[model samples]
Each structure stands twice: as C-alpha cells, then as structure tokens.
Target: MYERVEEMIQGYIWKDLGVKVIEAVDGEVTLHMPVKTRQTQFHGNVHGGVLATLADMSMAAAVNTLVEEKEFTVTAEIKVNYLRPAAGDFLEAKGKVIKRGRTLSHCQAEVFDDSGKQVCFVVATFYMFKKE
Candidate 1:
C-alpha cells in the first residue's frame, strides 16, 4: 500500500511540490520536501500555501491508509495555525487520523523545519468517496 501511494504521489500535485512519502502505516503518514527557492516568498520564508499543502497532503495520505483500494478521500476543510517562520533546507509533515467514520475522517498534521522546530499545525476533515 505504501508503494502504491508513493507511485500515485508522483503523478499528483505532490510531484510538482516535491513531496515524498517517507513512512506510511496504519492511519498515519510522514512526508518531507526540500525547501526550494520556488516554494518560498520574497522574504525567503516558506510560503503559507506551501506549508498548508504539505499539511493537507499528509493528512490525506493518512486517511487513504484507512480506506479500501477503491475508495478515495478529499479535503473537506482545513484549519492551519502558522506558529513560526519556516526557513530551512527541508521540512517534514506528520499526519495521523483522529477518527474515522463512515463518510468523514478527522485528522491532524504538524509541519516542522529541518531544525525540528514546528512551523505549522493543522486540523482537517476529509470526506471519503468511491471511485466512479
């Protein structure tokens, strides 16, 4: 399942963002991405959108682990708190499922810079659906 998810990441928006799945098990996932110039703002800090993307992707990946092969999930809503400036060569996002329901999943994620300082925290809800 981890290999399949890794392969799917290569074809999604994650490919453009350079996100790589480092670990995936049960209802948890860990991902990392290098801090490239293109992902930063003019002030040289990682952009909020990029951090949010990392959080979202990680949470979605966690949700995926709990669903069937034919099932998929979508981000229904996400709330993020930017705690500090993300300035580093790389960042890691860790996500875990808080609850899994018949149609919805509650998840949380945290993003940290290479220094191990947390840069952002996120809580999200995902809706599960079957492939058409």
Candidate 2:
C-alpha cells in the first residue's frame, strides 16, 4: 500500500513545502518539513498556518495509506494545539491513524522540533470518498 501511494504523494504541496517522507507504512507516517524563514510570522516563529498545513498534510498522508485506487481522503476538520513556538531548521510530524470507519477516519499527529521536543499536536477527521 505504501509503495502504491508513494507514486502519487509528490503533489504540489509536497514539492513546494519541502516535505520529506521519513517513514510511511502501516497506517502511520513520519514526515520532515524543512523550515524556511519565509514560513515565519511577525514574531519570527513558525507561522500557525504553516504548522497547520504540516499537521493537516501529515494526517492526510497517514489516511492515504489506507485508501484504495480511486479512493482518497479529505480533511473534514482539524484541531491543532500549538505547544510551543517552533524554532528550528526543520520540523518532523508523526501521524497515525487512530480509528478508521467506512466514510471517515480519525487521526492524530505530533510535530517535533529538531531537538525532539514536541511543538504541536493535532487531531483530525478526514472524509473518505471514491472518485466516480
């Protein structure tokens, strides 16, 4: 499943955000996103939007592992807890599928800084649908 999804994972955001797949298998995925100065807010910390994007994307990637051909997942909603100001050269997000249903999946992710400190946590619900 991971091998099949890997072929389709390099979409626009994956390329533009500089997201690297550290591990993606068995309904779990770990991703690395290089932090850029442009991603910082006025206070010089990683912007909340960037953190949210990473969190959402990581969850999506986790959900992707469980889908079949012509099937995909879209985030219906997400809750993000910014634990600390993200300050580092890069960030790592570990996403895991908490529960999977026929039409929805609940997942959670933790984003860590370079020092291995968790900077953010996110729980999300994604809607699964098949393309006609």
Q: Candidate 1: list runs displaced more than 4 Å.
A: none
Estimate the TM-score for candidate 2. 0.94
Clashing residue pairs in candidate 1, if any? Answer: none
lDDT for predicted candidate 1 compared with the true structure: 0.91
TM-score of each: 0.94, 0.94
List, residue by residue over 1-132, the lDDT tens digit for candidate 2: 385457646688788899988988878989999999999999998999898889888888888888887887889999999999998899999999999888999999999988899999999999999897
Could you give candidate 1's per-residue lDDT for residues 54-77 as a string of tens digits? 999899888888888677888999
Q: Tell me the deviation in Å of residue 42 in model 2.
A: 1.4
